[model samples]
Target: MEEKQIIIRGRSYPLFRCHTLIVGSGAAALNCAYHLVSFGVRDILVVTERLGGGVSNNSGSDKQTYYKLSLFGEGQDSVYDMARTLFNGGAMHGDIALIEATLSAQEFYHLAQIGVPFPHNAFGGYVGYKTDHDPKQRATSAGPWTSNQMYQKLLIQVRQQGTEILDGFEVISLLTVGEGEQKRAVGAIAIDKNKASSGLDSLVVFQAENVVLGTGGPGGLYQTSVYPKDHLGSTGVALEAGAAALNLTEWQYGLASIKFRWNVSGTYQQVIPRYISTAADGSDEREFLNESFPSFGKMGTAIFLKGYQWPFDPRKIENYGSSYIDLLVYQETVVKGRRVFLDFRRNPAWKGGAELRFEELESEAYDYLHKSAVLFGTPYERLQKMNPMAIQLYAQHGIDLAQEPLEIAVCAQHCNGGLLGNIWWESNVKHLFPIGEVNGTHGVYRPGGTALNSGQVGGYRAAQYIAECYRESTVTAESFLELAGPALERSVGLAEGALGRVASPNGRIWLEFREELQARMSRMAAHIRDAAQIERALAEAQAQWEAIHRFEFRLEDPARLIEYFRDRQLCLTQLAVLHSIHAYLQRQGGSRGSYLVVDPQGSASLEQLGPEWRFRPENAELRQWVLQYQFDSRTHHTAWEAVRPVPEDHFWFENVWRSYVNKEVFRDSADSR
Candidate 1:
């Protein structure tokens, strides 16, 4: 790799040339860097806004799971079986599913080998348990910090391998060349937060043959989001660079604590804490669930089931299923304008002061509580008995489960869709790979903890493809300048214009824009959706997207320029997501995945909710096609492609060995950008 300086708008900015430029420092991004070094590809650079600030290091549930191939006492399990399960999830490419299934064990072992501390039996067998949407018992966990441990272990490996890391840089634009099939990712332009206070000199450029985008999901799009505060995603820049998005409408929304921004899943709900609501001024508190549910047993059962069925699935709403609790919470916080809280200090109160008799509860809930020996205590006591770590975790963040109520909301947790990638995790743009949550590998439905597995598999696949096929760059310094010149000029112009604008000292322009965008997304594009609201939101998003480009900013602090760029990225991402949702509604798409599509002529209805909450069932046939959306800097385009079927090819050992030795395994991967 070589370092130089490039002048943009009379300000000299740093530039580096490398074989690969990784645009994040999360677990997946670090894993890619480690694998690149192990594969003998050393000319790589990693850029991130901050180390250990993304979701991988900062988010978890009560018992964070890690999905992988069953390695021990299994009734039966195979790569083909796992592939079929992932493929059947709907709107997922069969080949990509096969790749992920095939690599699950390898990635799992890599984590375990690098001190992830996954529990094992005395016989050295890794036991597994069932998770949501999983047929086989293929989920495992170390504790509540499974992904955080993975991030820490992988960071050690990456640092040990001497991979160059550049922190405090936020990517603003991807450098690309050509158009259509010939298009390719050259590098990226980033805003140096540390140097932004020095004005236009903050812009830095990277010239590389391949760019690995491991940035996480679009977490900034919603006001009520569970993603970590520091990890606002950079997916908008890739979309602006013409990366097609797939299944953008599929997202996971669930209950999470707002104060500490942690998931309140697993034992937190299994303990059956009291659900209460209060007036805006914190008075008039009452047990809200008791008024809606028919009996203590039914309500208790629903709350217990929420431990595992955490995500808000429309299918689970009828008959007071686990997700009904999600709807009730949504009703209280969003619809009724009340503050909802989980009172762990006491068990839920039944109508007429009827006690919650464990034996009278549903067998599933009853058996689990009986097996865990937690049938005789308050919710916090039961939680302390089952998992004291859940309590300590909150204590670490200044929240005590035993002392006070925990405020929560039905918030956006994860996106099941993102930039479309191939079997090797390469996007349509040649040389650009989107791994981790940024890559749309998961579909309408996925097993719990599958995102972690997919991120590792994607990093391994992307690294191998880069090392074997794209080992060096062909662009010299002169050619690199020609390619990145226009994009550089546009970014500098935006920065200059924003800095020159005048505003009052109290005006936090970025915060104003961010709140407006997040509020609109949470209202119109969250778990509950209506066609009319989506259409209106789409129009409003477009106007805001345009407004962000020309919005004035106070030069009171140039170091705050990263916020302006982040706001722009978030605005574009919100616009693209709205376009996707509007397109889905136009196609007569209905309630599916993690969200509900409300319609006036719908066939389904919730018991306690009004006609306005009536929703249409999913269109079964739509599951056979993946929704591909693109925004080419002007108009939003939508296309549908049939789901690729699982591969049925017979593999001959000798033939496979020949292909492996000849380096033909990556036949579809690009050798140059």
Candidate 2:
């Protein structure tokens, strides 16, 4: 074939090589970049396919219920709460020191000042509550697009710091120097912004001493994914760079992605099956849905079967501490000849919202008034003006959720385990720092809403560390050009490889492989696991590796996708998965949140509905909602008989009282307090 090469800027550029290269631009990547800049390190180059949110765009989980609220518990959740949650949430083997010390709570607050809007409660207050393992309510956020919002703000900060952003560029590998002993990461190899490799541009030699690998996780390896991100921009690249791929095989089943082929792709095209709710007495209520599926068929099937139908606590339903939907619940349904459903029409919320025709307002004042009206026992019509997604889903779909139950299921979502690294976001290898969905800072089943917080925290921490650590390194134009050379050559070869002979075989086979993988992974990696299942999964993953090696591939980008799959396979190796799975199983103490001991038949304890809340039911007409709640402090502690009592031993009464208030948090998350 004739040469398809070109020169640019008076220089013949090769593909690979660069100094201070970042692989992803998601929350993790952006956060790290910003944090790196904050550290006073300037020779930063961020190479990514996009500059927006991470995996969150695909997260269809109901976001109306916020994470931060006026929660009054033991510690009143703060930056400290994040550390506690990570420890309690089975990140026992994680780099707790980094999390404990580095995550940026102030940075999260700063995002708000940067124009990211946080949802206000009816009283126009910054709403917050104890969600899952978070102590107090420090998890302030800006709607469901927290990741997107954070990414936007962080991107602005990154650019302002004078770092060059190469968007849509594919990073092919890490550029190392010295033979072996003197081996160090000076930079990375990447294609130009167009993602072309006909000839390398800016090849090999963006020279800088400290390189950080912020490549993302390995979720794309599965046949189905919440991430429509193509271009082989995943942990596979980190692994290919020989970063000792630790805990890679220990792939955490992200919020189970559904199996579906959207008319479109990427997170924006995500569609969820409607899920309905009914009163505790089976007196049907409205349906509410926010959860998104990476896949539909599988997720729909899981939900059709209904919860392990775990009941919500009447008293603390908002917190829903013990009401975690078990992964095994769906697995059992499948194993027992039953399948989950993706029903939407039956959910109760849709019908009521359809009947109401109310649109929620975005202001804080109305929210407080709505609650005030509820405090005085106002009519239902006034409450719904604040809740719009519910109404829109109903009116738009014309499906009365009250009359019918909405179908729902759990599919894979985010990657809890990614390319392993230190708390600083650096992979085992030098210079490359894997961040966001690609970084495996978390183990399996990350607590709800933690990804945003963690990414922000990790980014800030990594940047600060890099700046302080590499204050002596030089980052200049000439040095960068020097590092760009080798990378150019590598990019050209890989781009050619992408277009060479390869076959994906049948998409059907790929689907089956994914299903089998899920089944194996779920059993071995679910809420409660056993040694046998872990070993079994290890064996199966090993076999799959061999099979994938034999599988055909097309020499297009999907070929890189094939390589991506292998990256996930390497991640699934026994070392990664077994260590954490076994670690989770090994912790032989109390179980809270999602973890529960399965009976021999997989039946576990159903928790009691502890308390009841005075709710202001939403109604039609006003189209603007308000919320006002009045509760006697004396009544806050409902039958929390099992909770420990506050000690009068020379301590702040509130802190002491929270021990009694958040008994479950202390007991459940252990470290959150």
List the lowest-lDDT window of 10 residues for candidate 1: 664-673
RMSD of 1: 1.8
lDDT of 2 by residue, 1-673 (tens): 0112334345554433333566677766776776666666665677665555345333333231223323333445443344445544443343332253234446546666776677666765565643434445644545434555666776787777787776765555555543323345666555444524333332333445566555455444444334443422345445445544332322322232233311111111112234333433545333323232222333332332222122111112222221222333233233333333333322212323332111232223234344544222111122233333433333443544334433223333445556545545555455555556566555323344656656666666566656655456454444544544454454445534434433534332444555566556545554344445666765676666555444423433332433334343343332244444444333332232233333233222332211121122111211111111111211111110111112223647786688657653224332211
Candidate 1: residue 195 Cα off by (Å): 1.6
Q: What is the C-alpha local distance difference test score of each model?
A: 0.88, 0.42
* Model 1: how far residue 322 lies from native, Å: 0.8
- TM-score for all models, in order of appearance: 0.97, 0.60
